[model samples]
Target: MDRIKIKSVTTLAEHWGALRQADVEYRAADGSLHHLKREIYDRGNAAAIALFDPARQTVLLVRQARFPALLNGDPAFMLEVCAGMLDGDDPFTCAHKEALEETGHAPRNVRKICNIYPSPGAVQEKVALFVGEYDAQTRQAQGGGLAHEGEDIELVELPLDEALGMIESGELTDAKTIILLQHLALERGA
Candidate 1:
């Protein structure tokens, strides 16, 4: 932990998230020193949750636009679990808030699925993942996400099997979504 010494950091951009480059001297395992420059996108952390219905073997998901995907030659619209930036709220609170905003169901039975860094090389953000149980009686609102935040979310409820198949079929590509789905699949022994 004390092997790396930071020399300086330069900000490249400062918008929704910060893009900065850090110069550092790293001490190798054999005691050799190496200089390195690393660029990181600091968007803060986020939380995502997969809402599942055990009785129906179904999961609640969302579809929305992702400009970054489009820019990277992938599908602009992504099918994913409900998620959002913490914005100062705790991970669990953020997950619940996103669930209510994007899926209409405030899950009562929620469990952590561990935190993950999908792009450790460039992104300085960690996501706290979760899975929650829901049912027909749990509908709190007609969720389509907040229009004011430019979020045009579409609710998609599909059988767990079908959702898992989407991963193999290349329809589900979001890392957080895939991780949560695979976790749920393993829990169900599917």
Candidate 2:
């Protein structure tokens, strides 16, 4: 922050999320001052969880429609780990809630992997990543996400190896999901 100086910020939109145009002067590494304007999307922070069943060597995931991806000419339906905006809860709580609501599993031994800014150049959204263990007994509900919220998610449980294969096959392209799956693979020495 010391190397950056804010000139001004103007709100451009605030419907689904806040979008602002920022005017800033930055001190370059070469001791030069540079002025620029950039639009930023502020959609708050989020949490995502990868639910792994160690005994079965499987992971639970959800497939849902993503309008943004559809708009980008990618598939409308995306296979992803359970995730949600924090709304007001802490990262761990949000991760657990989203896991239960999107995958029908109550996770245990949840551990944080890291925090990541998915689109740091233009978006102000940091997603907390976590890995949690799940089993048959943890399936407390038939999770398809909330109908009222427009989330018609489909649960998919696959062997860890198959899930990893999807990444190379272009079936699973979500960033957060990829990170979690790779983390699990590394953890299991796969």
Candidate 3:
């Protein structure tokens, strides 16, 4: 299908000093007039990276408290890859920094896997996904996370097979994490 033509956009409200409620008019493929009410978030785009150590047969995942997951009835804390919002930095650089801060791992070979829009319907957050194969020996810190940001992440090293099992059992709930795992399991055959 071709792109829809945006006829007009009007701001209706703003919330959290960041979210914007807007009304938009557009012409669909069939030339029908339609209006959409959307909640837009002016969030800076972000990136996430999955790190694997083939020799160790392990993947480094971060465990953190997520309010949404907690409220969604997930008893187990999330097991996710390193991720953070971009801040006037390149995707790879930001991902590398996130990995260090969140998992205490310095990524050696970061490769872009894909870019995705987490919530195109309402939010303007975009995620640049990456995969990295890193040396697992440098274990400088235990990855208590960046304390100043109130981040209390614990880096968990799981065997690739166990991580894949977590994915199949719906234990890993984070979308970007799941995407990375799926890519590894299917495309890379890792």
Candidate 4:
């Protein structure tokens, strides 16, 4: 705390997430002071999970439209692990709820993997990552996400090996999804 000082914070946007610019004063290792302005985006926090079925050696994922990717000329619909903004729920609760809503599968015996800051350079959001086990019995509804919220999610089940291979094939590019997949693969010694 002694090394940095926030001079002021000004809100730049307050829509989906709150974006603010912070004027900061920093003390360097060489005993120099520097002034810097940085923009920070805060959307509270979120949680995500990798849904795996041990019996089938497969994982359940979701595909949905991601405007940001589309805006960058990438495909609009991207394959991703089930996830959502926490709203007011705890990380675990959010992960469970999102999994059920997006894939119609409520994972059992979920184990949290880690918490990650996907873009600490500018985003003040922390995501709790988890691994959950699922099977056919867990699927209860024809989950396509909350259609009223415009979530047109599609469930994608793939063998764990094939899903991991997609990372090398340039198919699955979502970072959270990739991290969860890699973690799952490593945990299973694949």
Best by lDDT: 2
* lDDT of predicted model 1: 0.94
RMSD (Cα, Å) for all candidates, in order, is: 1.0, 0.9, 2.6, 1.0
Candidate 4 lDDT, tens digit per residue, 1-190? 9999999999999997899999999999999999999999998999999999988999999999999899999999999999999999999999999999999888898999999999999999999999999998888777889988789998899999999999999999999999999998888897
Off by over 4 Å in 4: none
Residue range 58-148, candidate 3, lDDT tens digits: 7899988887776877765788999988888988999988988887778776899999998798778889999887665645555667888
What TM-score, to 2 decimals, does candidate 1 have?
0.97
By summed lDDT, the worst window of 10 consecutive residues in model 1 runs over 133-142
Clashes of each: 0, 0, 0, 0
In model 2, the runs with Cα more than 4 Å from the true position are none
**Candidate 1 residues 32-143, lDDT tens each?**
9999999999989999999999999999999999999999999999999999999999999999999999988989789998999999988999999999988978889989
Poorest stretch of ten by lDDT in candidate 4: 135-144
Error of 4 at 67 (Å): 1.0
Candidate 4 achieves a global lDDT of 0.93
What is the Å distance of residue 141 in model 3 from its true position? 3.7
